[model samples]
Target: MARPDEHIHIEWRGGTCRVKWWTGEYLPNGRKRYESKGGFLDEETAMDYGRDQLYEIRHGIHVSNRKGATLMTEWLDDWLAGMDHGHLTERGYRSAVENHIRPYFARKSVADIDVLAYRAFRKHVNGVLGTGSASNVMMVLGMVLDDAVPRLIKTSPVERTKRRGKFTKKKKKERKKDMAPAVVDRLARNAEIFFGFPGYVFMWTMAMTGMRPAELYGLTREYCYPNWPGTDPRPDPDEEERYAEDLERYGLGDDRMPAIRVERQVQYSGGELQFFPPKYESHRTLVVPTFLAEMLDKLLASHTSRWVFPAIQGGSLGAVNFDYRYWRPIADGVAERSGPRVRRPRPAIPAVPTYRGKRLYLLRHGHKAWLDEDGHSKFAVESRMGHEVPGVEGIYSSVTVPMERAIMKSLQARWEKLQQDLRETDS
Candidate 1:
């Protein structure tokens, strides 16, 4: 039996019972508002359960406290502002939020985003932007929701979606392939024309030294001196002789061998060049060959700034600003002209979108390959490149300056041979 005034009633049959709540009758638009109380074996038990649920809802105990009206765009803005600035790279964070995340979900309300809608968004991102980009978007969304879980947001649709697949695996494959030395050289040669000799030097240095872009840009004239006192005191007989020969050959004093001291990096944050410690290995010194030393000296003398590679703008180089304005265009130009060495082709502008093209970060790869081919010990290579070797190997082995100098000499000799080959080809 049901009371007309009471919207909820319980019915039992043998071992099962149903508790039903009649929300209302059909409206003029043929829509119905109905609430349900699930089946239970005992009628009285079902009624009691339904009453408890109703009481919880009335008291706002079980109700979601999240506001349904908050737009995705608003949430994103707050998330970005609240993020740990030190943990996230400025350029990367900006790209993920502005270029990908906001463009996809800005107009949608948080409450309207269900699992199905999220899946559709993921599909759209994958189909149009590619899986990697879509995955990045999902990552950002997940991070935002993770922060919001304890606060205003109750559910995160990003958590429910499938983000990884063949596409992501393929992207990783492409990255590893791009790290080859030959690819780096082609990229460097092409970029040389636009960035000038300094740009070429900058790219090569990064490849060989494994110094971050900002560290390369932050190099100073004082840091490139031959007698850098901070260098490790290990002596190398072969390197000592080679360095002496180079100093004499160039009529340079003991001050000619280029020593690199990394005190800070130039980064663009908040629309300006900001000097900070290098992203990873911020406070270390590296020694380079005389040829690179001379190039750096000339660049420093001409630039007249604390920075080794100053922005064309008014101050020190900022990685993001410099890359966007200078490095990317040069990289694209190089990628267009470079291919397999078996066949030469005329240089042409790339037809692909600038944003969608690939540019190899060659300096680090070139350095590693050159060291490997020249048979320099891995410890020597790691030291010169300022990389911390993994595991017990790093703990037991120490690198001396003499060993570093020997490695540099070998690298320099190879570079000189390459220059001769280039000259012969030109002639």
Candidate 2:
């Protein structure tokens, strides 16, 4: 009988046997491919390695056994081609792959990206792009590796780190997103200076409603009122129309009962504008304070465009277009600009201490904080924020009419107190 080590070659070079064997694969040019392990002291060690390699291949766990060991760049392209995510998500993943990932890891075969190599890449990304971007890039890379498992890679090298003995140094403090009602009022008042009164209303609405920025940007006049004609009559989304309260049938129902439907948001994808349902499709009705409801009524009456918040130049605001011209000045306040663009253009707005250097998205965070402060039910709060609450609590609990009224009442009182404080300051 032929020995199992027949195909394995042993080269004696005055030290040890160099065992080499054919790998049952061919190059693109039809050349036979091989794998070798050199400097084996005994034929037993050499035989064991060759047998293990053969076993892995037969069991379909050998990475190089399939797809001829695809290169990282080629595999990334294949993976991206198969993605069916939303435009924004697609854009981000493509950006990570093209800008950060492909440049560093492209030349390597997918099988060669072992745990050590991937960890080094992680450290490099964190050092170069900072935490937030590194996190997103790593997410894409993890998914890419995971998809190649048992094909181009036997196991994914992505490490899901445990918190034990990690980062011994003191971490940075968590950023506070809690904003008092007065701080919101100040931001709104300054927003009027930079943009128009719409900016003022925009600030208030964002702070109070907790809608995502895109959701608010896509808000139309038709969807802003409690009686907005889209959904059928029902007390709760999961309930029957017979559960609709009598207070809902009449005009302007309860003063504290104005609701806005969160059906869609503005998405700029593929170099064109698009409308998509809210993130995670959390289409919901958000109750607004009576005063905010009144403001929307007036805003709708005067505004000619379909959008509740149109660009300063007209039409729907392109995503991130207003950052330099509108959001920065509104958030950080304009002190001065030293450029040769012209002359004395002092368009200054007082900076709110709470908002300085903070993102506009924090307003959404502040709304959640406010809701928590008011001790509202988690179900009601999560529903208002367009978030899916997890576990059995989410399954059983529902937002009722009383919860909506209570939220509206608290918000109205805050606004009233702010107004009172402002009046007192003037007096």
Candidate 3:
């Protein structure tokens, strides 16, 4: 070892000179670690190489010797296990890593992945997977590499070039615009035929309350209107005084203002369903029109189970069961399936004319559109949609009793108008 200002050690090899420089780090055995470059034609050239390595070491951007041997698969395992993300998210990351990412970069070391290597992986995923899946896979890869910066590699190579910006939008799938409320009603009518009365209730509640599908499935009799003994969304001890004050100003009672508490959703983790908070932890109460409130009260009376929107088979509805058994038959006509038939399909149930091949998630989007169309307060609309208002608006504005009443009135009027339209058609 020598002083930091002195030239690095150089030695004569078989036909050329070799250089080795102290890395200012030590091994567990208390021996100094050295970074080396060999087979240089002369000592000056070798000394230059040694200087660059020392500079990198000094700047805290030095790549370790083992980096060249650190395979992509090895890094993937270490990175995924370091954090405990939600089960669904972990599952998605693993799917992309194993099925798409690992296969291509498995043998390659982390140090070898550069911008060109990233572009190749991006092209491969786009060619093999759908546009959405490709985007997700790329995102996962970029995240992992970005995490490796300055430790396993100097910097992430996943750069979005101008060429990428030009073609990516063209390659990406166009998002479907929000569905019409009338279309949602048509879908509900079809669902009623397939999944009994609860089926009808599920569609309307989703469209009206803007609850996510999982939230609706996890909805319980206690959270829904007219059955909850008391109205206490914020139940902490410290909030009691504020709540009583609200009661004075807003008549905070279950009977006074019918609402649903967006508490939790069912998440499939490990092997069974577990209760998890709503996405973004958007725990808020949603006011429902009086008509819908009465309808829920009637349904909850005969329903013995805890779930508000139980499956047709009499259990809490899961995404898998809902999509194939209940939703597809209603969204896409039962008789019009494309895949090879296995068992005898159920008797033909006609699809909703306007919602053919559309997703149930669209109903939530349409709910937002309806709120905007009605010209409700931004704070109230975002609160109802389970979305946090951004910037100062979220900080200063709050959903008041008047806002909730206005929303309820607007929704009720929409429902009444639709009923009138149906009656006119029948006449």
Candidate 4:
């Protein structure tokens, strides 16, 4: 028999009794709430727990009484729906969920998540997606668990320092290789000749400015000051202020050099392209080499689109299309060595050294290396790269005009030397 006010039941499984009780509560949408306690020696202990659970639930405290029956998939759905994350971040998280997390642990109880289970999951992910993607999947899972702490889950099983897979900080840093100056020249020249104007400007700007791909893709005519101090509209008041005192000392004006104002980046989110601020809100202006400035001025004179580097087919350039269709072929070595190598219909190019598996981002790193070689201040270098310098140096030190001028001078010399080499090669 059961009390009429509260619905309670007892059952036996494998010579053990368990108790289940329906709390006299309903969801806003008219669904009943139920809880259970199990694996007890006898009905007496089970009923005691059942009564305790019912009391807790009735009084509006339900976390303690949760039976860990909530499926990971269900909780993740709720969590993801409520999260206010960036478009790319949300897309990646959803991908991790759909591709790896859901298939392995969606049906499992969150309470059952432990170190051993996470290790097993890591092995599975590594086996299928390899270390890089597996690393991203693990990070997403860790984020979900972190959010679930003391609510849906007891603790996060994924340790940031663990060596389960090859997914570690050191390994990630080790994977990024820098490009040589000659290599960058080759890439830019190949891009200009093979892919035309958009590719030409795109490669040159990325190599010289060290701007992120999203930032480069989002470059608009309005933000580019190809003639800078010599010829431009009203100067940016904030940028002027940042290096004003230094400029006064160096007898320089705001428009002394060509520059690009990096404010927002393009993101493909929610099945549409949207413009937003740079990652970590790193907004700054980058001074360009004189040669690049002249080239960009020429480029701007020809085109009328708001975007400086529009796609080849007349829309926004996507990262995937740019890498596979444009960069990959150039990096894998183009026809540069002889008469009419009819590989892909292009003619009269020489065979160059192939750099297989080299990434486009290495060009940006090469720019950083150049700045480093030129002995620029750490703060200035980091600022130019659109990265926030950590600790006290970032807060105190400022980018001086002399520092900017020095970097500009070095980059200009490099570009001039490259042009001379290209001219000599043509002759």
**Top model by lDDT, which number?**
3
1 against 3, candidate with superior lDDT: 3
Models sorted by TM-score, best on top: 3, 2, 4, 1
- Candidate 2 deviant stretches above 4 angstroms: 1-41, 65-68, 162-174, 230-256, 335-347
**TM-score for each candidate, following the candidate numbering:** 0.59, 0.83, 0.88, 0.76
Candidate 2, 1-427: lDDT as tens digits: 6555665676667778876666778889998787777888988898788877777766777755346467899998899999998767888999999999999987888888998888889889978996778889999999999998877777898988734334634446658856988888888888877657788888899988999988888987767773363333343566545324423532333343677778789888767778887888888878888899888878777678877877776677555576566787887888755567845444568888887887888899999988898899989999899889999999999888888888998999888998899899999
- Model 3 pairs in collision: none
Candidate 3 runs further than 4 Å off: 5-7, 162-178, 229-255, 335-348
For residues 39-118, could you state the per-residue lDDT of candidate 4 as single tens digits?
A: 88888788787877666556655554464557888888888898787666777889998888988996688877888888
Q: Which wins on TM-score, candidate 2 or candidate 3?
A: 3
Which 10 residues in a row give candidate 1 its minimum summed lDDT? 348-357
Can you write out model 3's per-residue Cα lDDT over 3-115, one digit (the tens) per residue?
Answer: 66364789897998888888787889999877677889987788888888888888988887677558989999999888577656778998988898889998899988998
Question: What is the Cα-based lDDT of residue 26 in candidate 4?
Answer: 78
| lDDT ranking, best first | 3, 2, 4, 1
In order of listing, the candidates' clash counts read 6, 0, 0, 6
**lDDT tens readout by residue for model 1, 221-308:** 5555433433323244655764454344332555434666666676666766576766654366566776677666666566556555
Cα lDDT computed for each candidate against the true fold = 0.61, 0.79, 0.80, 0.74
